[model samples]
Target: MSLFLIAGIALTGFLAAGLGTMVGLGGGVFVVPILAVVLGVELKAAIAASAVCVVLNSLRGSSVYLQRGLVNVKLAMVLQVSTAVAAIVGGLIVIFAPVQILKLLFAATLALTIGVMIARPNGGKRVKSGPDPYGLRASFDRPDDRGPAEYVPQHVRSGIGLSSVAGLTSGMLGIGGGAVQVPIMNTVMAVPLRAAVATSTFMVGITATVSALIYAGAGLVDVAVTVPAMAGIVVGAQMGGQLGSHVPVKMLRTLLIAVLLGLTIAMAADGLGFL
Candidate 1:
């Protein structure tokens, strides 16, 4: 590609990653569509490039969340096991799945994500007193200095089931799995939205790492496309992590819903051969 074209791609990657990180979607939601539809890249190639960006965004974003003590390490670790295994299966399926079908799946997933965000726009604020019997306790300091908050995760089994689905989508679509994970963690598991985002960021790195390896081994990844995109994603993820820490939960939810709605429309159009 020409220097100017490369620069434009990098800029797009930066914007995608920034938005994805802020909303905990990991940028693949934007990156894959732009690459495949706008840039005219092949679907598999676009997915591989998006997977690399997802990994970079997750690493940078998760580190920031960890430092703030927003991540639930134990819960993340438990969830990663399911996500990682399912991601490998998803990667294998993508090798043979039709591009049109994948596009439809992406659209459907985004639509579901929008519904989940709308249903639970606010992070659940009611905290049960006393220690959790399941030992899924997590604590984080509030941005407004209202003192630290603590909550126990409920519905562990359901969370794991959702994580597996998230992993499959992440591997097949090159998303970070946060779109599914964050809502489930917040709405079903009773974790706060920020905490859910943080935990999802951490787990998605592991999920994407497994899928990226599969794509790399199959020679699906285009290094020329992935490298610059990753460079931009790293910077954007840092900026997003910082910004997310300060933004209100309601605003973040609104941003996520809006983005998902837009992506849903684009993916559906593309799947129906209208784009």
Candidate 2:
């Protein structure tokens, strides 16, 4: 690629990573669409490049969440087991799936994500305060004056089921499964939105790493593209992590919903050949 083209790719990666990390999704959702639709890259190559960026963004963003005690480690560990295994399966399937089918799937996934966000706009207000049977209990200080919030996770089995789906999407689309995981964690599992976002960020790194390895083994990833993008993603993720830590939960949800809405439009346009 020409120097100017490489610079443009890096800038795109930076913006994608910043927004993705802010919402705990990693940069894959934005990067894949931009690469395939805007930059004229093939779908499979875009996915491979996105997988690399997701891994890099997750690593940088999760580190900040970890330091702030926002991540639920036990919960993340439990979910990662299912997500990692399912991700490999998804990666294998995507290798053979037609580009048109993938585009439709991506659009469908975005639409579903928007619906989920709308259904639980307040992040499940029925917070239960009790001891946890699943041992996933955790607490964190809120950005508001309400002090620290403590709660135990509910519907553990359901969360695991959803996590598998998230992993599958992550592997297939080369995006972190945060759009699926975060909503399920908050709405179905009764996790606080901030905690859910942090935990999702932590889990996506592992999920993306597994998928990226599978893509790499298949000789799908292009280092020329991945290396420059990764550099920008690392910087962007750090900035986003810092911003996320200070943002209020309500504001964070609003931002997430807005971003999802835009992504849905973009994906639908591309899938329907309007882009």
Per model, state how many residue pairs clash: 0, 0
Please give the distance, in angstroms, between residue 10's alpha carbon in candidate 1 and its true position after superposition.
Answer: 0.9
RMSD to true structure for each model, in Å? 3.0, 3.5
- How high a TM-score does candidate 1 get? 0.86
TM-score on alpha carbons, each prediction: 0.86, 0.84
Q: Model 1, which residues run further than 4 Å from truth?
A: 22-24, 117-134, 239-263
Q: Candidate 2 on 112-189: residue-level lDDT in tens?
A: 766765665556663557657778878887778688888888889888988999999999989888888888898888
Candidate 1 versus truth, CA RMSD in Å, comes to 3.0
- Candidate 2, superposed: residue stretches over 4 Å from native: 20-25, 116-120, 126-131, 143-147, 238-275
Query: How far is 24's C-alpha from truth in model 2 (Å)?
Result: 5.8
